[model samples]
Target: MANAISASPTSTDPGRIGVAVIDQDGKRPVQISAQFAVAADSSTRFQIVVSDLTDATEEVALFFCGPIRDGLDLEEVNQGPLVLSQAPNSPARYDSVLGDRSECSYTTSRLEPGHQTIVVGQSRYSFLARTGANVLYTVPGVRTVLTREDLGGETMAPLDPASTVSITMAGLPNDLQIAAAVPQLPDSGLPSWSYEVGGQPRVPGEYRVMGHLVTVENRAQATVFFAGAFVGISGAAVLWLIEILVTGALGGRPRGEPADRWEQTKERPPPRS
Candidate 1:
């Protein structure tokens, strides 16, 4: 494929991104779609479906440029040609072990002209995060690539510029209140991760970890005022007294006020009374 970028033996590749499909004909780019199922426990399931529109008579390579948390295994496939290329250090494996994650690529068996596969896997890996105290916390979201072979030593291709790829998150806790999400939203009102460069969509995923951004309302720490003083509650797992507001009397005395001064300073009734 003329549009395909070559991998460097020494330095990591930059174009490596989300799942990529190499079409020998390079006629049209493959179509890849993904959904991230995130659990409150921080565990995640990656459900991906990739299809090659070129539909070559021979087999082509399917490259996965993501974490190897559970290795890439097929959930379903078409009744055409296909093979698996995975072994110790084989070109087809999780992204990487220590350095240069871009070197990791998972190559799948052959696909006879325009084939699709349904893949479901998990990762103790990423895209989920939290900032701020428990009261106003955010559980934020949550890859790589290279070239080289199929059942043979394949050179995985970079994501095709014309390729259409979309990602969304799932399995969030029921109480989670979405405050904001990236790439904006539509009538669906659902939030998702957008992988793009320079405002253009479909950036590569191989070498870098990627995910969408989302801010959810943490009800427990959202905050509520009382008659006098507000309770400080930390949103973190191990709750702390209050990383924020302190106890200040609202109707009583006041914060930092000397008890004697407060007692002596009393309001007098109206002169007529």
Candidate 2:
């Protein structure tokens, strides 16, 4: 394994770089964790990693693409094609080589709702590249890790999160700035991958029909708690007038020790469908 595979950007891309590391290990199931550093121009760089396969000693074809739901093209999958920028001073680094998407196996669930089509993109240490005749190629990066190119690719079975990727963010431009700073990760306790492979449970837990319409002066109106994907609600609560959701001085540097802000903490109810 060479230690780190460098990332390259397109020539015509004149946008400034947003540096950040998206990291994860093979502790749990195949899950991804990411922390984004948004640049003023919103040019984002991501590091999707699966580490810990330094002990992987099996041979199997692997995948590196996303399981896109609605479907997407190569150009649409990545906008900068979202490459990892390797600055010499970056914290993250890799010792394995990237696997070509051309090698991975795929299975498509026909027109099925919540269907899947995996398109493994930029990957490392994953030996998905196949030979002309359909056979698992072999290579190693580290001692027992897959080779840079099997000429071919890895059977490092049961990949740990640190499967084969060690991408680093480098050459962070001197002028880069964070657009939005998240003081802490939210406790939402939800998986990063939004869509459930199989559609959500018919019901996550005990279910009951709740809420009802309020008829004031015979003008029926009701508020809702939540709505479903294709569900809709029409004659919900009628607001007296167009209302402001949040009010605060936006943009421009503030003056004095601290500026004041007016806020309404109450959230408008989700309309009943």
Candidate 3:
């Protein structure tokens, strides 16, 4: 029975990533240890687990940058709701049930003198997950270790006192820059993707929601090639025109002027006779 249970095909192992959350409510901040993993290859899956919530209805926001890929097309997967479960032994065990999911893409273009044309691809994902009857929530991925001292205590406050969580990736690319934003709480309802956050968004209270910014870059060589070809054609045309003008002046009949004196003389003698 033990061997049969261990060999079940329904099980999967998602790689672990480090993540940490800090609650900045009191004079001393409280840190919570969290774990995350990629659910599948077709889509980027992120799972976050924070233990011990003071209020089951309290909302927590997650913000981080996804792995950067080289391409113009920003690929995104449908995100599952923020799930809550008892402090599970593994991040993969958490279930996402109550939150909403969506997809979006952002782009910027640039033209440099010598470099190739670059189109910056940015895909950012953010959502609000309310705490449920349990403590675990599945929304994203990162890897870090936390202890009792870090979490402070079993009960931690939600987004308040302007708390911040930093996720560091080892061996990050040289050209990549990570950008994060904390959305402003809406007046009537939940926040939407349309609420743009330039660079980084700032809010007075702690940001209850957090998400990721996936930055990508795509270069097109056609623009530079076309520019070079245009410059070469223009130069050749200008030189050809200048040569025609110079040759005509040396022959005593510059461009736009009448025929040369010798031709005029030959025609005039026949007229006199």
Best candidate (score: lDDT): 1
Instruction: Report how far residue 20 has shifted in candidate 1, in Å.
Output: 3.5
lDDT of each: 0.41, 0.21, 0.27
Give lDDT tens digits, candidate 3, residues 60-161.
223222221111132112222222122322222231211111111111111123211212122122112211111111232222222211221332223322
Model 1 weakest lDDT span, ten residues long:
1-10
Candidate 1, after superposition: displacement of residue 237 in Å?
Answer: 33
Candidate 2 minimal-lDDT segment of 10 residues: 203-212
- Order the candidate numbers by lDDT, best to worst: 1, 3, 2
* Model 1 ranges off by over 4 Å: 1-17, 57-105, 112-114, 130-151, 154-160, 186-188, 193-273
lDDT of 3 at 206: 21
Off by over 4 Å in 2: 1-32, 38-42, 49-153, 156-273
Count of backbone collisions in candidate 3: 16
lDDT digits (tens) for residues 1-273 of candidate 2: 001111211112111111111121223222222222211122323333222122222122222221211121211122233222112211223322222333222221111122211222322232122212111211111111122222121112222323222112223223222121112112542111121112212101110111111222112111122332214333221221112211222332223213333223334589999
Q: Write the per-residue lDDT of candidate 1 for residues 152-181, one digit (tens) a residue.
A: 444444444555566666665555445444
Q: What is the lDDT of residue 218 in candidate 1?
A: 27
